[model samples]
Target: MKRLKEDNLKHFFAEETLKKYSVVFIIILAVMLICELFIFNFKWVNSAFDKKVDAEMTLSGINESGTDLKFTSDSATIEYKNLNEELKYLYFKPGSNKGGVADITLSAVDEANSSYFSAPSRTVLTDVKSSEYIRLRFSGEVKDFKITVNGMNGKTISKDNIGLNVRVPLMFSWIRFLLLSLTLMLLYVLRPKSFVYNYKTDLSKNWQRIVTLALVAIQIITFWNMIHWNTGVLEWHKSYEHHRQYYSLIDAIKEAHLYLDFEPSSALKNMDNPYDFRERYAQNVAFKWDHAYYDGKYYVYFGAAPAILLYLPYNLITGNDLPNYIAVFIFGIMIMIGILLLLWEIIKKWFRNTPFALYLLLSVVFGAAACLAYAVQKPDFYLVPSLGAIMFGLFGLAFWLSAERKNEDGTTSLISWRLAVGSACVAIIAGCRPQLLIVTVFGIILFWNSVFKERTLFSKKSLKQTVAVCLPFVIVGAAVMWYNYARFGSPFDFGANYNLTTNDMTKRGFVWGRTGLGIFTYLLQPFNMDAVFPFIHDFNAATVYQGLTLTEMLMGGVLWLYPILVIGLYGAFKKNSFSDRRSYRFVYFSVIFAVILAILDAQMAGLLTRYFTDFVWIAFIGTIITAFAYYEMLRDNEHSRRKFAGIILTFSVITLVLCFLSIFAHTEDSIMKANPTLYFTVQHLIAFWM
Candidate 1:
């Protein structure tokens, strides 16, 4: 019986399977070796252990009170006059700075040679609130050196928590290495093959559900991981203290009012031109921040759809205000589902012959793109409308594409319910994000053959279809307009012009010169790279236009961040490559609409990364469409098909990594600010040898 069992186990574990596993193990080992030697700069495995070295040092030009080194002036010095041997590292455990460091510098000098030694240009305690250990390394040998601090800005360093020649272990991140190995194995298995290219099998039909479930789980996990550190309890109208607009809007609606309950200060109301930021600051007047101030009333200038759809219902049922992070989580999952449904519909309708691997690649590209990450990372009231618009817009397009039905006699007819539902979803965008309502224009092109070419939209033969397509728009539009009128006294005025913000929007008309800067910054900005962990950094957007151009530090432009989207431009001109003419038109129109929205956002809102939400999705869709068509075109050439598929996967993986790390850049809204411990831990884990 034992011999028989062993034989059966051997049969199950074939030699080929063993060989594959061995290859994967060997690949992982090779990668770790390279990282330890070249990337982490570890000399030997035995050197991983730390060794303490003794040195005599003296401090000057600084006052030591308790553990703090308070600089008497703008500069201070620490001279290591004697050392047993050459020193390699100096470790520091920083003291707390709630207000954060400002223009601080620490320079190492071999004072005898009058030369500056290498060190971090700025301190590694970037997250000033934490007391984590940080180290400074020397390039060659350092028997004697003086460390100088300039531009101190009244900052203090911890005096007692310092060490010399602390030889810490040189370790590579095992978690990251294992993840890379798994990712490589997954890609190798999912790579294009003969079976994948066989369109008759329709492998996407089998894999779509599985891939979507995995993506949804990933989205939820990331959302929770970001918030788990801070979320302690739920409270009624909890976000009110944080000046959340949605919470306040729901509270007002519950009390049967159209405007927010926040009252404008009499001083600001009495002043002429309260919209002027300088006037508000100069007078020291207290007023609601970012609220619409019109005729002595404060109103929520942001869309009310999120409040009515999510916050109001939650408040009514549970008597507790829904937090923005929870709402964002729900919307993000819906967006992922909508992306899958839309991609499935498009593949089913037009690109039926698309390779299975290509479909999976597009799923990652569309579902987890940089724009969605930006919108979801800092969950707040500001992100609610953008997420809502994206979620519903994707569903609207998907339902619209799915409305066509094949009949018994080889003819097609529109499903009345599906058409009406799709229109209703599209109309909701006007309430959530007015700028994104431009997506509804695609409906006209989608039904052009039936409405204009065949004149069947209003014909007696298709009366139900006409009502299904038109009634929802009329009803939703009227409701949205009525809501607007109730708030701002006029249906046409959405109340943005009356906002008490940085500029007087009512008088800030368009400037022709701003267009050039807007386009360049939004579409053509390049990324700043460095030889450090999370190397992508933010850059100043310099423009020749002499105007008050409002721009924050930009990480990079959308096109440069995701270079794969450039294919959409080629797809626009290569109309003959597409199998479906209507699909070709959709791609062409998407490119134009993306450009128009970019110009609109740049002109109206100025340059910010969050504005990418307005148009990146549509551009990604166009690019994905082009990619599918290109893949199908290469069906006859197997080698070309495999090569193209590999290129798509490579671009997608690299782009996803860059986008996720972009959140950690030195920006105002960075992970380092929100959670300092997590940031430094990751920094140390990846660059342990540093």
Candidate 2:
């Protein structure tokens, strides 16, 4: 009977493992809940456990106006002339400016000594009209100290209406609990011995379609929420009005013209140098900003492809200007699909054994690594061209790869329609963002056998295939060139040189000196992190290069931000890893061309984070190719395969988190400014302790 009991116990532990481990997971979560409530957020626990108490001390200050102390300027200092007490919390009433929420930080010095300073506490004045008092946690034994408040944003903060040792409301942070639970659950599921490691590729076509559809659904929900800010409807405001350049171009197209409808002001046209920003400002001229002013006509200097393809058709059909957000949403969705399809096609061709989890992870990395989220976040005409180019680039490459099929003899044959479709998509990049035309050059290498080795100037089959590839380029190329020639008098000139904004682009020739700065800033710079909620901070673009270089705040380098991209170096450097030599060349050239484009963007346009869209996807896709290569290499060893997949999953999750945080960071047109309540709500949700 004892032996039978032991056998039954063994069966329960081994056969019902998930049931047993689930209980363990629940126990761990319960422990975490207790720790969070009792230890991490004990202040709230204490508040709940005891009745509320009034302030033990009150502080007052008088400004130069002899009024109750208010932050009249961008900054203010409040000094307690005499005070000696153990302070735990500070409170003050903040009045909003009605424009936007202000991020106010208070730094206090204890005992009038800088060395004995208390940690700074930041509070966002989210409610513009409410008379509620905001609280900041302060803990120190203090006497004769000063508190400095910064980032008033023109709002008045009452300093005299301040209280020390104030009791905060009972705060059971549900958000903190939810985040902890999710973290724990995710870690538990991805544990080394979990079934996640045992997952294998589902090779059925239906499974492939399901995976693609799942990604599409995720993209749909994500982009919808991002574009609408969780509101069911998109808000229309003055910010959209300023960036309706696409509508301007569409109106010009409706009138059978190439230039925009915004006529150049006579004061601006009469000036000898219309591109001179200071001269225009000094004269108070009313010319279109960022528009190409050549021969007194204002041209939308941004690529005309978005207008010609998307906005123009929508305007004609709907009899209204197409919103840039809609266009970005469409382009953004297609870009994600193209990324997944391209990756899927490559996986089908070469790395068929790649795990579904790895495939999902790399797909996400490539999609997010492209930084199309910036375009989605801003959703303006400026990013339309870049977004479209990446979409077309991915689709074109995917189609080109899909054209090849295996034969009965274990060789490959090319499909004509796929080649034509791929070439046409490749040619469209010229119309979208001409700088990204560099991607199309990969075609020659991709079709090395058909172009160089076969050398077909005649013969029926070869001629038909040749026409299949070249005809689309000819048609699209001719149309794009004609459009350019009609606008700029030269097929090659996209009219960016004549832009009447910022520096004179016509003379902003390439400087070799800027290349090093561009490479480091674009591809090598490490993330500047902080202890704050959104831990990642913008990379400072300050450099020693003494020149007029147009630089913008960067998030971080592509590699440092997405560490999985380092695997791309393995593919580029390793020659024997790939079974197909052409695939090897593709990876090698992707890295090479990405570097070249980075240098070009740095030299021509300077270092802007938006310009990362030009090459990051290329590097990311190359990395995906190599990551799968490494995964397939470990196919015989399940342990190594799981380890490799875990690493990819880990990096991918980190990258996704960083990408989400970036949208809320203090940057131009950030969500904090667009939707302050939502921003502060999420901020307080995740950072409840703060």
- In order of appearance, the predictions have TM-scores of 0.86, 0.86
Estimate, for each residue in 437-487, the C-alpha lDDT of model 1 and write its tens digit: 888878887787777655556688899999998898899889889988987
Candidate 2 Cα lDDT to native:
0.71
C-alpha lDDT score of every prediction, in listed order: 0.71, 0.71
Model 1 alpha-carbon drift over 4 Å, by segment: 1-22, 29-52, 60-78, 93-112, 115-118, 121-141, 147-161, 170-172, 190-208, 226-243, 408-410, 454-456, 687-689
Span of 10 residues, lowest total lDDT, candidate 1: 228-237
Across residues 154-241, which tens digit of lDDT does each residue of candidate 2 receive? 4454435455555555445565677778767766666545665455555366875776688679777877777766231234423444
